[model samples]
Target: MIFAIIIGMSLATMIPRVIPAFIVDKLQFREWVNRWLNAIPYAALGALIFPGVTTVKPDEPHIGLIGGIVAIILAYIGLNVILVVIGAIAAVFLLSI
Candidate 1:
């Protein structure tokens, strides 16, 4: 039935994520490994954001570039993520206008 299919899909999506956390919790990582893992999120974020930066405003990449630069500077200065995102959007909107 539809309910059973939905449950199955949810379990399929969750199990992979849940199993890794549980398994990794049981293992002890070396200092280098921990440092590498700590860097993963930042690296992933940059990877995700870089492309969007280039394509955010296809008609005017300059606006996106300006926004992205502001976002990066705000982030580097340890601003909150929400503020950084808001600042970037505001910059882009103002520049576009």
Candidate 2:
């Protein structure tokens, strides 16, 4: 019974997702629409990460802000992503100390 319920739930979840991929595969979007679609992941990532960045320390929110600023500057300077993330982590760690 448990196995049957799990299989039913999996099918219900997969059907909606799998159907869209098959349906959209044959469709051609405009160039601008394609560009917008490509940007969705980054936009979604920022929306998700920004809140966590701001609340890293409830009493001292500025530490998180400073870390975010460091990350932005490193990214703007074209540093590697790993370096940018490490720099941000280091900034926050130092500030907390």
Candidate 3:
């Protein structure tokens, strides 16, 4: 069933994040990891932004524009995730009207 598959994948993912610590203790590596590891977050951020900024709906503001810029600033300040999401929603609501 789909549920089984989901559980299997969830465990598989959980294993890798935790397994590295144990495995690394058993081995040694002098070489650095692929830089792609570090870039994924920023790359994902851009992926989310590009379309949002380029496409505008009657109710939605352009991504990376004023609302998006404000969201980015709030995020940069490390605001709570729930608050950030709510703030972004408020911004959209206000700007759309």
lDDT of 1 at 1: 100
RMSD of 1: 3.5
TM-score of model number 2: 0.64
**Candidate 2, which ten residues in sequence have the lowest lDDT sum?**
48-57
- Comparing 1 with 2 on TM-score, the higher-scoring candidate is 2
- Model 3 agreement with the true structure over 1-97: per-residue lDDT tens digits: 9999999999989998998778867765444644665677999989988766645463544632666677777889999878777887787668778
TM-score of each: 0.63, 0.64, 0.51
What is the full ranking by TM-score, best candidate first?
2, 1, 3
Q: Candidate 3 at residue 45, lDDT?
A: 86
For model 1, residues 13-90, the per-residue Cα lDDT tens digits are: 999988977798789999999999999999998898877787887887778888989988999999999999999999
Give lDDT per model, in order: 0.90, 0.93, 0.73
Quote the positional error of residue 45 for candidate 3 in Å. 1.8
Clashes of each: 0, 0, 1
Superposed Cα deviation of residue 88, candidate 1 (Å) = 1.7
